[model samples]
Target: MTLSAPPVPDNDLMRYLRERGSTRNFKTDPIPDAWLEALLAAGQRAPTSSNMQVYSIVVVKDAQTKQKLAEFAGNQKHIIDSPVFLALCADLNGPALACEMHGTSFHGQTFEKGLVAAIDASLVGMTISLAAGTMGLSTVMIGAMRNKPLEVAELLGLPPRVFVVFGLCVGWPKTSPIPKPRLPMPAVVHQERYDASRLPELVEQYNRELAQYYRDQNRETPDDAWTQVISDKYSKPARQHLRQHLNTLGFGLE
Candidate 1:
């Protein structure tokens, strides 16, 4: 992959969207402390559910720790090579303890509540990615943290009622990866009636477009484009059912 300067930001946010790509290669240059701080600050500035902010970010920087995380992520080298790795967690311990200290009872820690926390953490994580991109940094989201939820929780020293939601890699880009193809706008957006009438037609057009995109990039052609990919995904062996796992981790999915 060859590197290239970012496209200048034009009127319609084209440059911002075009230049952003998941970067895997990173130079050995040490990331500046202020830039790291700025990234975290941008994450903190993102919206939270009811301002509870029941989430946390664990910075993984030590070589050994990064290796451990990388191993957990199926030995994805980028996890270890990136200057920083963040384990975004959904946390209930903070609010629970805060309530305990104040002699106040908090009963909103339901499965839905946990969902909100996870969403908040994810939103913050993506904000960091955007902020990093704006500053010429690169990033990749790691959903593989859920591969071994229990192990990740132990590695991060997460307390009861706190669990790893996802991971992220952040660093300067080494090369410019081409932007992946996306479905057309109309395929996603809907008006008041929630019109899904155009789905079949839209899917067909998108499949053709995506196949062309793949061919242009010299990538292998997908069998049936988006729909087939999604069908195959669900057809695969099931992943860990989080309900029971959450029981051990202190999330009452009831």
Candidate 2:
């Protein structure tokens, strides 16, 4: 049976969240400039560290540019199909400049500063996804933009102290996929003090749940255990060169 899309909630944020899923298939329909601007405004409202919004959003609408971006992101068709693609960047130039103007020491090149900026940028991207969903739009986040960070920076004409964190595709969805099941609350959430005794059991139960979820969708289930899936993915050091890339962008990972 084809998994049906969850029903839209009646003014319920939680329900909407429960129904939310990453949309890979996007229609070619154009999003109105007003709607796009509104969505961006909503993303801008996300909380920032120390009120220092250390993030930049590069909105891409040009077809050839989108195609090149798609190629850079492992040839994801969604990047090209979506009417809009927003490249979210962890930026330190603004902070550095601000500090310079105030005759203070700039710390934007530090590893810790880069981490914080990345967090801020990720938060804004998530906010944009949620905002777009609420407005009957669909979105998919692409972290593969980091596959060639330097090339991406060059394509976007980013100066030193700025790095692309991720890309977000936005537009009307061609089809709605069911939300993938997440680990049970007990497995992820903890009471005041951390508890780990039941972790093994909890993980096993969720593994079964996810396996059944995949079976229900008639998708080929390769790995049944969630732990196994994660282990296999992280077994090798992926993106190990990112440290050097960040260094080249003026971030001191020291």
lDDT, candidate 2, 65-177, per-residue tens: 89999999999999999999999999988889899999999876677888889999999999999999988899999999999899999998899988899999999998776
Per-candidate TM-scores read 0.89, 0.92
Q: Write the per-residue lDDT of candidate 1 for residues 1-254, one digit (tens) a residue.
A: 99898986584335767756788887656679899999999999999988989889998888888898889878999988898998998888778888899999976458798788889889999888888888888899998888778888898898888878889999877887678777777778887668888888888888888888778978787846777887888988754566677668887768
Itemize residue pairs with steric clashes in candidate 1: none
For candidate 2, give the lDDT. Answer: 0.90
Please list the Cα RMSD from the true structure of every candidate, rounded to 1 decimal place.
6.4, 6.1
Model 1 lowest lDDT segment of ten: 11-20
- Give residue 204's lDDT in candidate 2 (0 to 100): 83
Regions of model 2 farther than 4 Å from truth: 1-10, 223-225
Compute the lDDT of residue 99 as modeled in candidate 2. 90
